[model samples]
Target chain A: MKEFELIRKYFSERGPKRKDVVLGVGDDAALTRVPQDKLLVVATDTMVENTHFFPDASPRSIGHRCLAVNLSDFAAMGAEPAWASVAITLPTSDEKWVEEFSNGLFEVAEYFNVQIIGGDTTQGPLTVTVCLKGFVPENKALIRSGAKSGDWIYVTGSLGDSALTVASKLNKINVKAEHLEQAQRKFNYPVARLAAGQVLRHAATSAIDISDGLIQDLSHILNASNVSAEIDVANLPISQAVLDSLDEDSAIEMALIGGEDYELLFTVPEEQKGYLEQNATAMGVPFTCIGQVRGGDSGICLVKSGQKYPLPNLNGYQHFSSEEN
Target chain B: MKEFELIRKYFSERGPKRKDVVLGVGDDAALTRVPQDKLLVVATDTMVENTHFFPDASPRSIGHRCLAVNLSDFAAMGAEPAWASVAITLPTSDEKWVEEFSNGLFEVAEYFNVQIIGGDTTQGPLTVTVCLKGFVPENKALIRSGAKSGDWIYVTGSLGDSALTVASKLNKINVKAEHLEQAQRKFNYPVARLAAGQVLRHAATSAIDISDGLIQDLSHILNASNVSAEIDVANLPISQAVLDSLDEDSAIEMALIGGEDYELLFTVPEEQKGYLEQNATAMGVPFTCIGQVRGGDSGICLVKSGQKYPLPNLNGYQHFSSEEN
Candidate 1:
């Protein structure tokens, strides 16, 4: 365990230092101050080897994606990420592995202005858990239960690229050389859509990050809001990389049910639509309207090119399943 | 997959509902409020199977001990624990295992008035990570750096019982039948001296929880305060359970360097010693003055019956060590 000491040194010395952090990293606990008018928001996510990623996955990507996923959750709630606590369990404390992992982790931490306050590093099978804390203005957090029946459903950025990347690696689909890099980048280095979420806090009725695919996550909003939704498969945002790798139905299916896309899925009411469209540039991401919210509790109904689309047999990634998709 | 839903349902429906939690468990992130006059305290601890516990360690004990260790960190800081985010990675979703684990977790949460705000559950090797958030009055935290020369060194409660239990399990010692259950309980359900920590916040110059043993943890205070210490081995507060199971020398060794005791090791200036003694009843634990802080950084100097005592050979528990002691 000298590695333990080294690991602590690596974390304590690196990363952004926030003024609100009265103390950071070295003590039994870190002490911080939250602004008086803001509510603290907390989100946690865990990635496991052979379950969330491949055994040969790059340490950098693992580090980046684990924190990215949690930040995306804060984004969904329109929270400004402030601090993070990471718990990493690995089989060995390989110095090079930890170095690269820290690089990937601190890169995002610095960019998001999130201070790595405290964490634990233990020896075990590879697993990374990040708990993110942020702040949202009082009564300003976007939540699933707030969606109304007449709101227009929208998504930020393109989807399916990350899922397509996973499919390519599993040999379920073959990706072209020109498109492979884009797909891999989309999967490994996801943008959390923080700016868009902040923009949506004023205009959107409800919001959720697309972690468990569009349909599954939209179902969560529908369930919470007691409303139904109709998503137009033809209008689903699919990147060129996804279109080139698979057929139309396959691309649509990937966008609807494949997981790990960190884009925001949100709904805007009729009165807020103009406000959203007028300030589109402020969102920092392209937005597309894919459907509309409907009355009642019928769940999600799919439509494509003016026709009803059949639901796919496969579901979004189920974490506890014996096998990964 | 459905088990994931069931697991989520279990956590969302149980635990103490706290007024400070604006939103918890079901959303992308939990929302909480921190009182204006307090600084937020954050601590994280992870427990991995085979490393932190045996394969057959009860699910209930695992859950309780995992959160207990983190809460102990809060206790050391004299913080009022408020919220927690738990990330649990397991090989399978055994209903009984999860049920018992939740029971144990909720038991501590309810007792401490800490709410389970958010968490993630994933499939992997058995591991549990807990991140706890609390509040402390500004500048009132008992940090390790405040110990001063000539300060009285004190420890709350008895030590070595937890370590003796581990030694017995490893066949290094034989525990008397009368003391076996007490030793196991002390190891499994070690109490965090929250009340004592609060009392010391006003009087003690520095403090730390004894997760890493008396010598190792006391060294932390010495190093941070840039001061040395003389610990009287004869005055160590060892439990009857420890004394009954081991010889005098072995018992002292265990008390000096064994880990997981979770008692408070603190230093009080000469001026505050009277205040501390007068508030001993409010501390809610028996405390012993076992040593005194010295000027300069010569590290810890051990003494027994007024003669210099040799340091023990064993070191405290290191998380990344290959073999458990």
Candidate 2:
């Protein structure tokens, strides 16, 4: 398909027009009106073959993951996604792939009420980069530097299922049929905790999305907040699917250090703990208290049976690390 | 180097925190405060190796062009660039290439006062995509649908030199040393007409950046505006360097349909022509009156000596075109 025709058929037809989007895709640049009292949150994420995804990964999964990861950033900032642009580089212009990819992208975009504003298509290896623009009230954004020493650390939803799915795919590991599908689905369409983030904005002091493993990513929040954390391994949110497929120790380790979960990890003040628990229940999202923020040299630790144990130096998803999968 | 170390050494160190940027890179995401009265202009462009640029092109030039093309999108919207995020995919972590690329990116970014805020890096075939976010007064953005019949069409700077430079590079066409350098520079670092765009936002009825050659890209504006245009071939702006290097016929054809000249092509009211001309002169940017918008006729024509000639039917830079460079 020609570039213009491909764009019109797939992307241009998918997004809903909004009043704030004065102009959208098919223009040289998209025009969006930002309300005077709001701050704009912008973030970009790129997925590449053999790096962010498997070479043979489904196009739908790729598109879903690309936008989902970016939305995770918005969740981190306590912002609502308003508009997004996708720049896709492909080895070839395959109509079926484009159709599926656009469907995947628009599925999530429509859910978030985000307009597909602008994009570029080019010839190259398959890579998808999406820039998401969101809006938040002034001074309402959650930042990594706002956590206090006495804040309680928490994570929404379960973790490690995506990592387990990756392992199963790579080794062709045969697990219980239902558990296998559940793990794979979690890997393919990890949801960004946008609702939880919106509620936590009022109570959380610091926030981050788990793209890297929980331990490493939470370390970023700790380091930025200038505090240390002690996460109870038993309290870590491990999915039943992960637990069914592996031993408790291995499942807990994966939950702590496995990447691509796309859940939000945040810190709430001690005084607001009750309010947070109540609000989270009202929101219908599970929240687990895993640790407490403490002042000192900043690092993460694991607590077991009321005894503190130093965590291993194994950093999560360092890109260059030679750690075995 | 590790991914985190590489990110800190290059991207994190270059962009200083600005007032408008409430939060910058190094966190989970960047947060910025946008003026309430302004419309936010957003654009994304991707450059791929052996596709957008030559495989052997300098990393600095690659970086510069990557950012420059996105800036051109902002220029098309008549917006002042405020912030940008870059997502790069590389085959491997080459420190030297990353250094030069980051340097080139920062040079133009600093010049334009655009802060580099957040981005993602991954492993893949070499690709760079930059998402530019800018601010413009609400209702002041230049749109492609604003042109009307009888409007005067104007372009900033000469066209086709960049295409000629690409030809020269590929064929090793040895022109005058100065001409070769000028052509190469044009191909490498075509400046986005940001200031002219800002000034023309009110004056120009419609606007677009000439990326896919003049004839093809102008068709987009015409299609969007529901108008056609008539060009005076004799008055086409061909730089002396391009004319000196190629025959007049080839030069005219290149100027008409060659792509990658990051110049502004816009339409203004007939009454505002003199004002635009004077403003261009004051800004030290060239203003060439080459055409006039007309009723939609489904085609562009060239008028020479009061005789109309049908323009050649070369669709600009079609990826599937059999003419493989």
Candidate 3:
């Protein structure tokens, strides 16, 4: 089938229906309405073959993960996911591949009520770059630069499962088949903490989505807000899949440096911690307080027992700079 | 240099200044404020080596062409270009290539006051996908579906220059060195007809950017509005370079179906033709009326010397569909 035909057949009508989309696909561009008093939050992420996923990875996973990562950015900002446009480069004309890819993409998009408003398609190596537009009410958007001294750092959901799957794929770790599969699910389909993000919009002082490793991404908040952090290593959220597979130290390392978790790392005033924890439990989002903001030059340190340890590495998945990913 | 270093060192802090960007680059995303009463107009285009440009094409030209093509979409909609996000894939981390590419991209962007808000860089086959966000006053965006019967069809600038360059490069046409260079300039650095589009916002009934040849793109407007067109081939704005390089017949055919000119193809109500014509000249944008919209089923035909002719193929450089370009 022709590429345009394939696009209309597979991608054009998928995702949640939208009201503010004045014009959708098939036009030269998409026209959408921006509501008054709401600020638009835009984020884009590119996933390339091998660099971001495996060649044999399910096309559905590829589609899901590409859009999923971008949605996580909106989640970090406490924004409502609205619309998206994708530019997909495919090496060959593969009908089934595009079908499954669109299905996967729309599945996640529909889950968040996001509409796929427009896109561009080209022939090349498989790569998907997606840009999402969301909205936050005026003066209510969460930002990384709002953390201050006396704020308590917290993270939603357990970390390291996604990175554990990568280790399993590379044979760097040994685990039971079922356990590895569970971790793989987390790796392939990690959910963005949108509910937690919204709840934290007013409760949290600052926030960032952990695509980079936890400590490394937390440093961004510290730097942006001109504050420091002392994270209690023992308080880190350790998933059962990770704990049952690896020893404490390995699990901790993976939790610290494991990337692609899509979890929300946030800070709240110490006074709000009491209600924030209760509210998170009520909302069914796991919340763990793992650190405290400190008054000082911007930096991050780990607290183990009573001793402060310097960070191992502050960079995560930086292209060409570090080979960690 | 690694990809991240290349992005920060070369592509960062370029382009025209934009004050609406609350957060630009360096983070997981970019945040920009859209004015209260304006609708967001967005378009995305992807350029892949061997598919959209030659592998040996100048990095500068390649950069300029990718963004220029996207801006053409904004021009088609009569929107104000505001910001852009790029997902660039390079075969390797070449500092010089990145430098030249940034120079070309920023040159066009700054001219239109479009800011580089955020982007991703990675190792892969060379591909550039850019998404532009623009603004249009509510209810004022020009669309392809607004042309009515009796509207005069017009196009800005000459056609087939870029395609002529392609023909020259492929040895399909022979031209003097100066003519070939002039054609190459058109091919490499075609300008988006923004000024004309803005002047036509209220004057023109419908509009589209001619990236994929005149006939192929005009068909979009015709199909969208459920109308047909009678374009006079003799009236097409054929450049002297194209005429000198090819026979008159071949030049007309190229103008009919050759792609990637980056000009505006629009329609004006007969009543407003007087205002549109005078305003276009005042805006320093060439306007040529070549046809008229007619009441009929969606289709297009060409006329030369008062004789109706069958339309040539109307498909543009569609991926895996047309081999015209």
Candidate 4:
């Protein structure tokens, strides 16, 4: 009937069992044992209704997206997600909505073996803030600053699909039925490449998960590592949905500026290129070489049809600012 | 600048250097190393505009309260506060508000040596959600279900000040100048009682932080331990602000039903009573014995001058529900 009571009934008591969770929901805090040899990985993300998602967004998809985004962070670091805490606010106490939301949350959590541990439920506009924790071996965590000149840049899975999903959802573009379905699935439940991330731990020189557009997110690695990048536009991984709905130039533009892909963008040194490709493929996640880390202070270029152009000055979908891109 | 750029400038680059933070806030996720012998403690709390704070409330205070509440959860679990991630949503990108918020957050964080690890900044109605991670020794973490009959119930710090602050701020009651200042401090920056929690790990049989009022929160401990408790009204720790503003009956009611004290409510076995008192004092936190646990399937009682009274059919400050208390 009340917030706490409803939470314990639907979330706490029903949460999947995990041996490492020494304590779960209902306590002031959840206690979990971290394996001694690993470092703890933490990331938090918030999804605001009408801002991050449509007002009519399915509770399940919203829930899945909230956790998937956080898992994407772990994926970038080559970490295995272990636990999660959610602080959700709602305008009203609708039991059905709450159930659906938790169902969506638990669905992805269960699939990933991430335990839903502790969080607060409050009254307000609908917002879901999820904080996830995972672990990686000491000194082995992938970092953006490790990119080096001569490293081969790679990304997991195709890009532009999620961006196309948003475009189609807004009716800004016309997509075929199958393309729409494919876009919607990618839009709602873009999988986190956990296994591929783990495999890249030893192979990739540096890594980041693509939440912002490929261009903007890649620039972070360039800025952090003090290196530039040369992306072969033709080599960009274009999703079939986008390929079917848009021209080559528009799809490439979408891949560069469109975000929410939750795919890993990483760099591997020349010597480890073969190792990374083989391992990523064996993990059953697609891997594509898109660019090369170059020896420059700070610049990015797009090479297409034998011409090189400076990277577009478009900013990705930054949540709380202008949307000039 | 975008949300990410603003965050990097104000929150990340400016965050204190903490050794346990293997990698700080620029990566997809922050990496932290938990001590080998301890289990990770996690809790999340969100402060929503209007529901949790006034629209014009001080940003610094809001920031302080967000982390303080999460730290309170750690205190109840006998965990050492360590790292925190904040997911803050804003109606717009106001640089002044962002700076002040980070100031308040870092102020409290620095006091406890806690690290500001990672989080997301987004556009939406103003909301602050904080997720904290602490560490508690394996098998020594306190829980509500550990209480036993005959255990002495104790609470740390004075209570009802925060409630008085809310009442005075809303014009429901009048508090004197000095008392208002005291109440405001308690309202915005209640201490987490971390040291007291650590000491209690060796002495307290069960513990919980007082959040959703004394009566209801204590009932959680009773229900979990399959026991009941009787609180002597005279022993309830009333703050000067509350005493100055309300009559004895109302003050007692506030103490029982006005939550958000962020103080520890704990039970110590008969033999460990002296140990708790001595250690709590040594840790510079006051402790008062308010009641005794009793063997029962489910019940709570109140004692006035010597007579046992049935626990009031009163509800505390439950969000998204009736306000009949």
Please give the clash total of every predicted structure, in order.
0, 1, 0, 0
lDDT: which is higher, 1 or 3?
1
Which stretches in model 4 have alpha-carbon errors above 4 Å?
A313-317, A321-325, B321-325
Q: lDDT, candidate 1, residue B273?
A: 84
Clashes of 4: 0
**Per-residue lDDT tens digits of candidate 3, residues B2-87?**
55556767766666767898878776667788987788988888888888887779999988988899898988888889999878
Q: Write down the TM-score of model 4's second chain.
A: 0.95
TM-score of 2: 0.95
- Write the residue-wise lDDT of candidate 2 on A165-276 in tens digits: 8888888445688998888888888788888889988899999888878888887888777889888888888988888888877778778878888888999998888889
Answer with 3 or 4, whichever has the higher lDDT. 4
Worst 10 residues of 4 chain B by lDDT: B316-325
> On TM-score, who's better, 1 or 4?
1
Q: Quantify all predictions' global Cα lDDT against the true fold.
A: 0.86, 0.82, 0.82, 0.84
Candidate 2 wrong stretches, greater than 4 Å: A308-316, A320-325, B172-174, B313-316, B320-325
The alpha-carbon lDDT assigned to residue B267 of candidate 1 equals 93
Candidate maximizing TM-score: 1
With a 3 Å backbone cut-off (N, CA, C), the pairs that clash in candidate 4 are none
Name the runs in model 1 displaced over 4 angstroms.
A315-317, A321-325, B315-317, B321-325
| Single-chain TM-score of chain A, each candidate | 0.96, 0.95, 0.95, 0.95
State what share of the real interface contacts each candidate retains: 0.66, 0.60, 0.50, 0.64
Query: 1 or 4: which has the higher DockQ?
Result: 1
